[model samples]
Each structure stands twice: as C-alpha cells, then as structure tokens.
Target: MSRLRSLGVPAALFAAVVAVALLATLGPSAVERLAVTGLVNLILVIGLYVFVGNSGVWSFGHMSFALVGGYVAGLLALPTRLKGQLLPDAPALVRELTAPPFVAVLVGGSVAAVVAVAVAVPLARISGLSAGLATVSLLIACSVVAAQWQSVTRGQKGLSSIPTSTTLWTALGWVLVALVLAWGYQRSSFGVRLRASKSDEVAAAAAGISVPVQRGIAFVLSAFLTGVGGALFALQLGSINPDVFYLDATFLIITMLVLGGAGSLTGAVTGGVVVSVLAEVLRRVEGGSLFGMDVPARPGLADVVLGVVLVVMLLCRPSGLTGGRELRLTRRGTGRGDPTREPSGRLTPVGAAGGPGEDRS
Candidate 1:
C-alpha cells in the first residue's frame, strides 16, 4: 500500500495533465499532431531521465539509439515493395524482412539495448564532463554512420512509407508504461544504488555498491526506452531521417530534462509538456500578425524562443520546475533532508535502515 501511494499519486496527476491536453487539442488536426508529438517527446525525455536523472550524468548519445531503433522499425515495417523501391541495395536480410509494427518496435528496442551494452562498458568507467564529451563523440560517430550508410537508412533522403501505427492513444499508452516503469525503477534497489553513486561515488563504492554495474544497467534500460521512443516516432510520422535524431533533437531532449528537474519523474513529464506547448505556440505565432498587429513570419523564431526560455529557466530555477522532488498528495514529515537527494540521501546498505525496503513516508 505504501508503494502504491508512492507511485500512484504522481502517475495519476501526470495522467490528468495529459488528459487535459488531449481534450484541449482534440478538434484541430494540427493541434492533435502537436499533442501526439508532445507525448512522443515525453517518452524520449523520460527515457533520458532514467539515466541522466538517476546517475547525474549527461548523455548526448541516447538519440543515437533512437535513430537506430527508428530506422530498424521503419525499415522492417515498411512494405516489401516499398523497401525494394526505396532501398534496392539494402542488405538481403533487411530487404526481405517484414513484420507487424509492434514486433518491429520490439526488435528495434532490443537491438538498441544491445548497442547500449557495448557502449556502456567503456562509458561506465568515466564520469563528469569527460563522460559527457565521450557520449557526444558517440552521437557524432552514429550520425556519421547513419548518414553514410545509404543502403540501410536511405542516406540523407531518409526512410519513408513506414506504417503509421502510433496514434495518440498508442503514444499515450506507451507514455503511461514509461512513466510507471521509470517511477518503479527510481524506487528500486538498482536505482537507489545508482543514485547513491551519483550523490557520492566514493562513499557508495565503499558501501559495496558497484557503481559501474549500476550505471551500465541504467544505460541499457535507458537505451531501450529511447529506442522505443524512436520506433514510435517513425510510426507516428511514417518516415524518418538521420537528421531527425541529431543535435537539435538532442538539445531539445536535454532542455526538457533539465528544465523539469532531471532528478524526478514528475519533472520529466512537466518539462516535456511545457516545452512542447511553448514550441507549438511559438510556431503558430512565428507567422502572421497576433492581436491584429502585423508581424512578419520568422523561420527560426521558435528555436530562438526555446533558447530564451531555457536560459531563463536556468537562471531562475536551476533545480528545474520541480526542484528535483517527486510530487505527493499527503504531506507527511519523512525526516528526510534534501528530498531531492539521490538515493534518498541515505548511506545505509540495501537492506538496512532507510534502505530500499524502508517506508519512505
């Protein structure tokens, strides 16, 4: 019951927010697209949160996993005729493949997880800014490979004619799943250990936590979620390009994560929604007059506005909108210092007082 209280309240609140968004945007097709896309972004941002939020590490490379998953699912789900027409020189296995959208998405996510394991081995040993830079290098390498590999990804032109299987309901379903998984994981032993390392690496190691292994687990899980997001993106658009998962997307995802309090699931959802809504509003206003005032269209105005918002958020609320804390309905004094502290700020071993099994409330 305590566990349910811990996870259910926040999940319910987040769902309410999503429900309101859906209702507000239901009539207009463009608005509906924005809502769906926002949900997709929510998934991606939460996927990012699983690692960056828990481990206090930045990753510029998760989008690479997204790209891989998108392409893998898109390629497999495309009609065989379309594949042959667009990717005539694709590998025989790829060209001959066909699957339902769900299966393709699963395969894509699994492949991304495998790649993540390979990447995590080396990354688990590094930390701080050096680790971030190493991940950025990985992103760049993946981008180069994606762009240069014409046969599989269709090169710069991108892969199109994918099945459109990611409706708003579909995206929402996955978002809920991601939310529950993220919340549950954050309260789990692995998540606690990983966050402990984030809070104090040497202390956590001294307490018998294998920091590298915990980090690797988070990385792999994060990659899987990101891959799922990528597959959903392709399903939603019926097309994808390597560029779609590049630097701009990276910045947007990071901004959402950072702007919401990278340490909390509530923050991830809030940040994704806020950024998505703001961007859509800006895009709509970038062209034509507002309030009967003549305003010329600005091609890049939305980006500029987003940058400004991010800067303002950083200056005003460095811990993000949620201050890195989960939302709870009941106000009980838990006697916990720094509610946002990773691993509940407890130094106890896994089964000891204030450990994973202890009642947080």
Candidate 2:
C-alpha cells in the first residue's frame, strides 16, 4: 500500500496522458487538437525549464526561438508561389530556398540555436534580473521585428501554407526527446556547473566554474529545443503569427516552471500538463452560458489562473510541485522530499539511484 501511494502520482499521470492520446486518436472532436497543443506547449515549457529551472534564472524570450523557428520552417515548407505571394518582396535567396517538412524543421531549430549563440555571447555576462531583463528585451524586440517584417514574415498577416504534419505520435517523440535531453543535461558536468552558478555564482566562480560559458550553453541548448517545439507547432497548425509567442505565452511558460518548482524536470513537465488542462477547462466554462448570466470568455483567464497558482505555490511550497524531487519509477524508495527542508537536494542521474555529493559544480 505504501508503495502504491508512492507510485500513485506517476501512475495516474501516465494513465491520464495515455488515455488522452488514445481518445484523441480514436474519438474525434477538438480532443486531438487540444492534445497536440498541450504536448507542444509541454515541449516548449520543458525546454525553457532546462535553463530556468536548473540555472535559477528567468528568460521571457524563449518564445522568440519558437517564433523564428516557426517562421523559418513555415517559409521553407511553403510552396514557392505561395511564399512569393505572401512575402512578395522576399529576397531571391529566400524565394529560391524550400525544404521538406523534416529538413525545414531541422533548419528552423538550427537557426534558433545560432541566434541563441549570438545573444548569449553578450547577455551571459550578467546575472539575476539583468539576465531576465535581457531575455525579455530580446522577446519584445523579436516581437516587433516579426510584426513589422512584412517582406519576410508577412508582418501581422502571418505565414501560411505550412503542412499539418505533427501528429500525437510525432509530438510524443519530441516529448521523449525533451526528457532524454533534460535528463542528460542534468547529469552532465556542464549541468553541474550551471546549477552551481544558479545556487551561488560567486562560489561557483571561486570553484573554477565558468559561469558565463555554462549559462550561454544552457541558453543555446534551451533555444534549440524551443525552436524544435515551435517548428513542430508550425507543422501542426499549418500557419503561425508573431502573436503566438508573446507576453501571454511567455508568462504561461514561466508560471509552469515556477509553479512546478525549478528543481525538478518532472515537475516542469507536470506543471505544463496541469496548467494546460486547467486553462482548457476554464476556457470551456468561460465560453459557455451557465445558469442565466452568461460567463463571457475572457481572453486572459489562463494568465489570471497562473498568477493565482504562482502566488499559492510560492506561499505553500516554494520549491514547486515536485518539491525538488523527481519521479524515479525504477528506484527503490520514495521520490519526494521533506517540505521543511530546502529544495536543493542533489538529484541522481536518471536510471542511476545514487547518493548526493559535495559541491562539485
């Protein structure tokens, strides 16, 4: 019974996700769309969590990668005639270039990684709010550029003709990729250094860790994953606009990280699923007429819910939903933490039930 309780949460989550996927595949409605959307968001949030959760820094512009990646993939996937019409003044280079879905997505993610490297070179020098603000500035600046770049992005009109190719199976594959990447990163020496910097930058520097470089690597890697997620999103939606990745989406992703607790990758992914379901439910309720007074749908209820959740999470369990502990289904003991203690307990590599170590990062 104790073992059952210990495994209950993970079991339930797996069952729920499996059930949703099965239903979406068999039954029809908006279930498939919603599942794909949730899965894509999950991928994006988990990617951001790789840096924000582990490094104790915030980045509001992770979505910028998504925007650029989506556009790049969309442009490449689009037919030459369609691209010419939508982006009439596009460069000959752009008009001449086109790729299949798989190749386009790869190029999109690579572009995002290159952009991240460019931004991280300078921005990684700073820490705390400065880093956060730098990323936010990047987000806003990208938003402006995406909104106004009519020749390439179609400005506010957005890009179309993207193929709807990201199905549940494809998204699940990406989810698996995210999990593996995050797990590998968390266990790597690089991840150790980044976490050390997150906990205490001065101490890490004193210990010979290059804080700037690690942070930059995290940024670039996180950007690549986010870009992949965005490319997948574009393939699923078959179109996209700059409005997709903005303050609203940014806040939601951040809220998922914070509410889930920055200490555990599992927590970040779980928070994404939880918040997505909550938002969907709220949207349905808000859109429908209840008893008599129609509860008109407000566009920002998800934000309001996330704000409340953040406050509650901070007050009740500052470490997050996972309390800094991960779900180790193959392990022999409980995978939770003591609430009274700090949430900085060392995490073992996935599939290796090891003990904690000294400050090694």
Candidate 3:
C-alpha cells in the first residue's frame, strides 16, 4: 500500500533505534543519560530543518527561539511555589501567565512566532551572509537579555523544578509534527517559491513573487517549531540555564546541518540522529585505563568528532550526505515539468501553428 511504502523505511529504522535504546538503557548511568540527551538533540535538529532545508539559508539563530520558548514555558509551567521561592516580586505576571502544560507550550511557540515576524521581516529582505549575520546578532542579543533578566529568567541560576512531561514518545510526537510540516512545505506553492528564491532570487522577484514575504513566512514558521522544540527540551530536562543556549550550541547545529546535507529534509533528520548518536558514543569513550592508571577523556571530544565529520563532508561532497535532494521513491518526473507535453494540456510550439513553413490551408 502507498501508506506502507511511505512509512516503510522510517518504521524499520524506528524499531531498530528503539531496540538499541532499550539495550542501552540497561547500561551504566551515563548510557541512560546519553539516550535522553540524544532525544533532545533530535528535536533541535528537526526544527533547524524546517528553515535550512526549505529556504536554503544558513541561520545560526534557531537557538534564540529555543531560549524564548524554554523561558516562556519555564515561566508558565514552573510550579507557583518554585516561582515564589525564586522570585517573590512578580506574582502578577506569574498569576496572569499560569497555564496547563500543553497550553503553556503552545503559548511559548506562539510568542516565538510573533517575535520571529518582527525580527525576520526586515532581515528576510536581504539574502546570503547578511541575513545569516543578522540572525547571529539576534541570537547574541537574546543571550544578552536572557543572561541579564534576573527577575524573569532567574539570570544564570535559571528557573528550576520544571515538570518532566516529555518522554521519548512525546519527543517522537514532536518529531512527527516537524516532519509533516517540513514535508508539506517542501511540496507546497510557497515552498516552491522559497526554493526558487534560493535558486535565483532575481528571477523569482521578476516573476511577481514577493521574495521577502516568502522568506519571512518560512523563517517565522521555522522559529515557531524551533520554539516548541525548546519547550519540549526544557520539559524533558526539568530545568534550564542560559548557558544551554550559546555559540557552541549554535555550531553543533551548523555541523549537523552541513554534515547531513543542508537542503533536504531527510538530510537534516539524518544529520541530527547521526551526530547525536556519535556524540553519545564518544562520550562513552573515556580514555581507558593503561597499567592501572586512568586517562580521562576531556571535554570537547564531541566537538572534535563533529568538526572532523563536517570537514570530510565539505571536502568530499559539499552538497551534503543527501546531495540537497530528496529520496522521492516515486516515479521520476511523473507529475513534474513541461506540463504542456502531457496529453491533458498539450500545446503546439509557438511557431509551429502559423510559421512560414506551414502548409497552405
């Protein structure tokens, strides 16, 4: 069946991953910890895919929405007692903003979208490195605010005692949301316009498309999903600090995007899973004991591995692991290109019907 084929690979892969996770969970505490971390990384990578895959833009600020969503949800979902214990002053804001967990998460996502609209509208008007740099600036600005806003974000200490409402199942549900949105966007008219703009911005504008508007819509939607992912991440961890969102985190995302191939939805997903798993594997490898003396694995090992993967991918095949194209198991060109050649809408060449070589009627 069509449905079976559509799910065929993902289903098999999911089963395999679940089995492996079950096995790993029985290991030492570190292995279990790795599973949780990987799940959170999976969510972040999928959110990045929404923008990077469709719009063909490298945005370094996806984590800004993560911060926004995390804080919004944290503020809303944190227990009233904890909020009081942390910051006794803003009872009004806390009272006004209290919400059910899911509702609070949605509100956080919506807030991120609103912010995206304001931030992206102007930036979307530009392209290439300018837009990228502008977004990087946005992320830095967010970090500054998050660090200094002691009352709302609790500054570096961060609001603690968040409820652990996200499980592996819940994370998968979020991934499904991201996958559907990414797939639908990749096939829609707006997606087509966005891709065209990426391919040739001048031609798209000449065709009467509003390039800036299209870019802004994609950028904002991407931010919304990224925000939701952040909320889920906070829920999974049951705590958050501003340090979680930083330049190192941004580079991790970039490395995932570049390693997996930047322009395809599948590539983004694959890149996320691959990098997440690889990081976990490397973490398990503390320098082994030699002659009863232990050599510990230092921090930055994961970064080293990702850096090597990225370099190799860029040098060997810059298009990415998937080559910026979808797998698309269906018949090639079945419903694509030169529709006039088809029986339903066949048309003679412009000159064929009334050219100088035409026979006399």
Candidate 4:
C-alpha cells in the first residue's frame, strides 16, 4: 500500500502528460516531430536524474554514454551494404552484422552500462568538484576517440542510413519506462541510503552504508538509461556524429536537470517538458516570426533566454519549480500530531505515559 501510494501520483501525472503528447501527434507532421523530440528529451532528462538526483553528483560525461549507444545502435541497424561502403576498415564483426531495431537498442544500452561500470570504479572514490572534473575529462577523452576512430565511427564524417524505427508512440513509451524506473529507484532503500550519503558522507559511512558501492550502482543504471535514450535519438534522426553528443547536448541535459529540481523525479519531468517547449518557441522566434508576423531573427537569442531563465531560477528558487517535492494528490503528514489541531490546544508527545490532564502516579 505504501509503495502504491508513493508511485501513484507520479504515474498519474506521467500518464496525463503522455496523453496530451499523443493528442498533439494527431496534428501536422511538424507538430508530431516536435512532440517526438520533447518525449526523447524527457527520457534523456530522466536518465540523468537517476544518478545525479540520487547521488547528488554532477557528471558531464554521461553524453558519452549516449554517444556509445548511438554508434552501437547505428552499426547494428545500418544496412550491410551501407556499412561496407562507409566503414570499409571496420571490425569484421561489425561490418558483417545486422540487427533488428529493438535488439540494437538493447545491445546499445548494455554496452553503455558496461562502459559506465568501468568508468564508475575510479569515479566512485571521488566526489564534489573533483568528480565533476573527472567526468568532463571522460567526455573529452570519448570525444577524441570518436573523432579519431575513422574505421568504426567514420571519424568526423558521421554515421548515416540508420533505420528510423522510433515513432512518437515509441518515444513516449520509453519516456514512461524511464520515469517509472527513476521514480521506483528513488523510493527504494538503495535510494534512501544513497541520498543519506549524499547529504553527509561521514554520517552515512558511520551508519554502515557503502557510499562508493551505492554511487557506482546509480552511475551504471544512469548510463544504461541514457544509452537507451541515445539509441532512440539515433533512430529518431536516422543519423549521428561524434559532435552530436558533445558539449551542446551535455549542457542542454544538465540544464533540464538543474532547472527542474535535480532532487526529485517530478522536477526532471517538469524541467524537460518546460525547457523543450521553451526551446521550440525560441527556435521559432529565431526564425523571425510569431503567428506569421514578420520579425527580425536574432541569432543566439534562444540561448540567451535560456541562460537568463536558468540564472533567475537559481537565484529565486534553487530547489526548482516543484521545490524538491513530488506532486501528490492527498495530504499525509509524517505520523506526527494532527496538523489541523489548534495552536492553543495542549500538545502531547507520542509514547507519553499519560494524557496532559491525567497525571501518572
């Protein structure tokens, strides 16, 4: 019952949002495309939330996981003829192989998880600013490798002709899956202990919780989900390049997490939706029009707006729009006194031997 109650509100909110997106898909193709992009962003943000939210660690390298997943999925899903033409010197296994879209996605996520484990071992020992810098280094290393590896990733030329199998509905389905996984993990005992460690490392260690192990677990899980999002991203576009997963994407995803309240699942979802919509509007504005009116295009205007919004949000409400609280329909106290009680009324502590007026002999 308790678990159900915990999951219910978020589930309902997710369903409502998905339903609206589905309806939007019934409109023109542009609208459908925008909706699909928003859904994909939602998955990516949720993936970031899984580790960053629970462990309170900032990772600039997660986009590398997405890059890995995208490449893996692209290699598996691209036609053999195309692969031979584009990647003649590729590994014999990759050059000859082909896989269904679903299998490709799974394999991509699995490989990303493996890489994450390898990365997390060293990362788990560090925290705060140093850990963040380590992740940035990882991102740089991955970018260099991707750019120099001509045989597999085609170097800077990018990979194309990947099968487009991700529809709007498919993207939405993945978003829901990511959301449930993130929400469930946050409510689990592992999540509780991890959060404790996040709050105070010494106290958590004293309580017998292995901080490194918990953080590693979160890191791996987050990598897997982010990889899945990457696979979907490749399929959605039917193409990818090493640069696609670099700094711009990293900043965009981190912005979503920070803007939405990095501590809660609801915040991640809200941030993704709000940012994505705002970005789309800004993009249109950059095109020099509002409802078909002639307006001058201001290059970089969207980014400026986004930056200002982020600064204001940080200064005004550091906790995010939700204020670090989940959206719940019911009002339930923490098993303390009745909140509705009058202030002048006598207050009795729990486990008391007798009521206030009844003295114990």
Candidate 5:
C-alpha cells in the first residue's frame, strides 16, 4: 500500500499528460503544435526539478545541458548529405555519421549527462549564490561557443534540416520516463539524503551525508533529462540555434518549476500546465484584441505577464500552487505543523524523532 501510494503522484501526472494530448488531437494544427511544445517544456521543468527541487540549489545553467543535447542529437540525426552542406568544414567523423532519430535522442541525453559529470565535481563544492552564478557563467560560455563554432553549430544561423521526428506520443513517452525517474529518485535513499541536505546542509553533513556527492549526482541526472528535453525540442522544431538554449529558455523553465512548487513532483506538473495554458491564452490576447484591451503587441507581453505572475506568486504564496506538497486524495494536511504531519514531511532531522520514514542509518 505504501508503494502504491507513492505511485499516486506519477500516475496522476501521467494521466494528466495523456488528457492534454487527447485534447491536442481535437484542436487545430497550431494548437496541436503548441501542445507538443508544452510537453517539451514540462520535461525541461521536471529535469530542473530533479536538482533544484531536491538539492535546494538554483542552477541557472541547466539549459546549457539541453543546448548541448539538442545540438548533438540534431547533428547525429541530420542526414549525412544535409550535414555536408550545413557543415562543410566538419570533421570526417561528424560529416559521415548519422543515426535514427530515436537513437540520436538517446545519444543526445547521454552526451549531456557526460557534460554534467565533467562539471559536477567542482560545482558540487559550491552552494547558494555562488553555485547559481557559476551556472549562469556556464550558460554564457556555452552560448558563445555555439554561436562562434560555425564549422559545427553553423554559427549564428543555427542548425537546421534535421527530421522532425518527435510526435506528440514520442514526447509523451519521454515525459513519462522523466516523471518515473524524478519520482523514483525522490523516494530513493539518494534523494532522501539530498533532501536532508537541502533542509540543512550542515546537519546533513554531520549525519554523514556527503552533501557534495549528493548534489553532484542530482546535477548529472538532471542534466541528462534536460539534455533529452533539448533534443526533443530540436526534433520537434526541425531546427535550433544557440539562442534557443540560453537565458530565455532558462527563465521560462525555472518559472515553471517555481510556479508549480519546486519542492515536489506534483508542483512541477502544475506549474508546467498552468504556464503553458496561460502563455497560449496571453499569446492570442496579444495578437487579437490586446492593445485596446490594455495590452501591448508581440512577445514581451507574455514575459511581462509571467514576470508579474512570478512577483505575485512570490509575494502572495512563495511556496507555489502546491505549497511544495504532493497530492493527497485520501487525506488532507491539518496545517498544524505538528509531529503528525504527512509522511513526506518527515525527512528533516528536526522531525526525525517520531516521523514516518525517518533515516535511522
């Protein structure tokens, strides 16, 4: 029963994604396209959540991994004939290699995970403001590389001509995979220790939890997922530029996590759906009866509304829509903040004395 209860979170989330996909089929092509985009973004948000949610560390550079995955996957999936034209100066190996779309996506995620591992050791040692800033720097560095490496990335013109291989079902399949991984990690001993550290790093360390090690694991895992999201983004669009994976993508994804409640999987799903729908509505409003309706034209409107929403969320309810709590169909929190709290709230050392799932080791 306990194991089944834990599955409630992913089951509910999976069903919700399926419902959304079904609705997408009934809409116009544009709406269907938007649905796919939303699914991709949700995957990205979940990827970030794996690290930021559990580690309690904000990583602004997580999208860099996505950028890496997208490009690598795109390159691999591109027909060798197309590559010869798009990347005339490419190495013999890169120029000659091509793979099936699914294979390309897998490779994309693997490479992204490798990049994360490369940086995890040093990044693991930093925390708080420094870690966040370090990630931002990583983003900038990667964007610069992508823009200037004309021989491979095609410079500022972007990479294109890859097959559009990611259908709605393809993306949904990846979403389920990400959901399972995120939830499984959350329930694992690794995730427990990581959350323990997030609640209080000093105390977690004192309890023999290697804070850096846990952070590094989460970082690499999150990057792999993020990378896959990027690859899907690339496949869905059939093209990509360095700019696609930089700050703008970063902000939107982080907002999804924040709006949903970064501390829980349920929150991640909520934020992703809410933002996707809100953006779609706001988009129509901007293009339709907007300026006269006290709205400006073009893309800035969505950003402004998102910014306002973020501020409002922070001011009015900093913990997000779910308050960092998972869904509960069979019970409700009394809001008493007592020792008899929900089983999920018992990971902290302060609550360990008599709480459920307390770490006795």
Candidate 6:
C-alpha cells in the first residue's frame, strides 16, 4: 500500500486527465477543442509551477516566453511561400526555414530556454515582489519588441495561415510528456534544492545550496516548457498576435497556479484543470445561456467574476484548494503523510504534510 501511495499523486492526476479526455470523445467537436485548450493551459501551469511554485517566486512574465515560443513556432511552421510574402524584409533564415509542427515546437522550446538563461542571469539575484516586477518588465519589453519588429514579427500583425497541427491526440501526447517532465523535476534534486530555498532561503544557502543557481535552472526549464505551451497555442488558433500574450492571459495563467496550491505538483495540475473549467463556464455565461436560463451578454464579465473569486480565495483559503497538500491514497509508514518530512526525516520537496504549506516568499 505504501508503494502504491508513493505513486498516488501522479497516478491520480493521470486518471483524472484520461477521464476528461474520454468525456471529450463523447461530446461534439467544440467540446474536444475545449479539452485540447485545457490540456495546453495545464502545460503552461506546470511550467509556471516549475519556477514559481517550487522556488516560491511569483512570475508574472512567463507569458513573454510563450509569446516568443508562439512567434518562433508560427514562423517555422509557416510554409516557405507564405513566409516569403509575410516577411519580405526578414532574413533569409527567417523567411526560408520550414519545419514540421512538432519540430517547430521543439525549436520554440530551445529558443525560449536561451532567452530564459539570459533573463535568469540577472533575475537570480532577486526574490519576492522585486523578482515578480522584474519578470513583468521582461514581458513588457518582449511585447514591445514583438510589436515593433516588423521584419520578423510583422509588427503586431502577428503570424497567420500557420498550419494547425495540434490535434486532440497531439495535445494529449504532449500533456503526458509535460506531466512526466514536471513530476520528474519535482522529484529531482534540483527541484528539491529550489524548494528548500523556498522554505528558508538563509538556511538553504547556509547548507551550501546555491540558491541563485537553482533558481536559474528552474527558470530556464520553466521557460522551455512554457515555450512549448506557446507553440501549442499557435497550433490551436492557427494564428498569433501580440495581444494574446499580454496581461489578461498572464492573469488567467497565474490564477490557475494560485488556485491550485502552488506548492505541490498536484496543485499545479489541479489548479490548471479547475481554473480552465471555471473559465469555460464563465465564457458560456458570457454567451447568454447558462444551464437552461437566458443570461444577458456582458462583455468582460468573465474577468470581473474571476477577479472577485480570486480575491475571495485569497482572503479565505490562501493556501489553495488542497491547502498545499498532496493527496495520499495510503498512509506511507514514513513521515506519517507529512509532505515536508521525507522518509529519512528530511523535508519533502515542497512542504511538510498537513501544514498550511503557504509560500513565504
């Protein structure tokens, strides 16, 4: 039973996701699309969790990485003919390169990783709200570049006529891959060291853990995954624009992380699923019908409603839905289910089990 419980967190998440996918098959095409989008959002949230959740730093700028990824993927996936017409002034490499959708996604991740390294070098020195502001600044800078760089980005006109290659199976396959990556990272020493810094920065540093280095590593990995998410987004929409990667999208993605309890991998996945579902419901409400009732169309109502819910959640349950705790299917004899205390009397990656597990930073 303890052995089974050890795998419970990932296993349960896998089952839940599979069940949702199965249900999508029963619905119409629209429902399937929603499922694909939800999967993509989950991937983004997982990326966010890699840095923000484990490192106890809130990043409001990861979407900029997504924007970069989307543009790169969109360009690479565009046909050579269209690229030439769309970006007549672009460099030959930008105008001529063509790759399969999956390959484009991989390239997007690589570029995002490089960008992340550049950002992380400077960002690793800060923490708390300062780091968050720094990231937001990065996002703004990237957005401006996207809007002004006509030769490559088309100056906010963005990419269009890109092939839509992220099907249900493709998205699902990536989702599984993302889950494995995230879970593996969380269970790895890098993630553990980051989380240790999260719990006590001074203590972790005293213990010979290079806090900045760990943070930098997590930041790079997080950006890579987020870039992949961006490519998936472009594939889904069959187009791209600067506006899509700005404030509102950032708010929604961050909300998913906050809502799910950012400390645990389980929280990241749950937050993504729950917030996506809530957003979809709010969208349907905006469509003028809820259940069997006729609702008035209220533009931006979804954001307003979600904002209120977020505030309420912050006031009432800041630790999030799981209270920053992972669900254990069986009580492992070691640590008595405390997520913080490992079998060897060490701290768990995130927090001690049964505690508030709130992020101090």
What would you estimate as the lDDT of candidate 3?
Answer: 0.70
lDDT by residue (210-289, candidate 1, tens digit) is 99999999999899889999999998899998799999999899999889888777778888988887887787689965
Error of 5 at 82 (Å): 1.0
Residues 1-361, model 5: lDDT tens digits: 4555556658878898889778979967988999999999999999999999889999999999999999999999999999998899989889999999888988999999999999999999999899999999999988999999999999899998889999999999999999999887877788888888988899999999999999999999999999999999999999999999887888899899999888788889899999998988888766665334654467678889999999999999988887786654333364344333345422222213322123322
* Model 5 Cα shift for residue 72 (angstroms): 0.8
Candidate 6 error regions (>4 Å):
1-8, 331-349, 353-361
Enumerate clash totals for all models, in the order shown: 0, 1, 0, 0, 0, 6
Ten contiguous residues with the weakest lDDT in model 2: 352-361
TM-score of each: 0.90, 0.85, 0.83, 0.90, 0.90, 0.90
User: Any residue pairs clashing in model 6, and if so which?
Assistant: 338-353, 339-353, 340-348, 340-351, 340-352, 340-353
Candidate 2 lDDT, 275-337, residue by residue in tens: 877777777665665434577777766567768878988999987777766654333334355
| Best-to-worst lDDT order | 5, 6, 1, 4, 2, 3
Candidate 2 clashes between residue pairs 3 or more apart in a chain or in different chains: 261-320
Instruction: Give the poorly placed runs of model 3, Cα more than 4 Å off.
Output: 1-33, 286-295, 331-361
* Candidate 3, 1-361: lDDT as tens digits: 3333434333433454466556766877666656666666666776787677666678888899988998888788877777777777665677355777787778888888889999887888876898799888999899888888887777888878888787666666666666666665655567777777777788989999898888888888888888887887787788888878678888887777787777766567667777877766565454654345666866667678778888888999997776664443333345445222223212222112211112112
- Model 3: clashing residue pairs? none
Superposed on all Cα atoms, the candidates' RMSDs to the truth, in angstroms, are 4.5, 5.7, 8.4, 6.9, 4.3, 4.4
Candidate 5 has an lDDT of 0.85
lDDT of model 3 at position 300: 69
Comparing 3 and 4 by TM-score, which wins?
4
- Give one digit per residue, the lDDT tens place, for model 4 in 245-307: 899889888888889888777778889988988898898888766677876888888888988
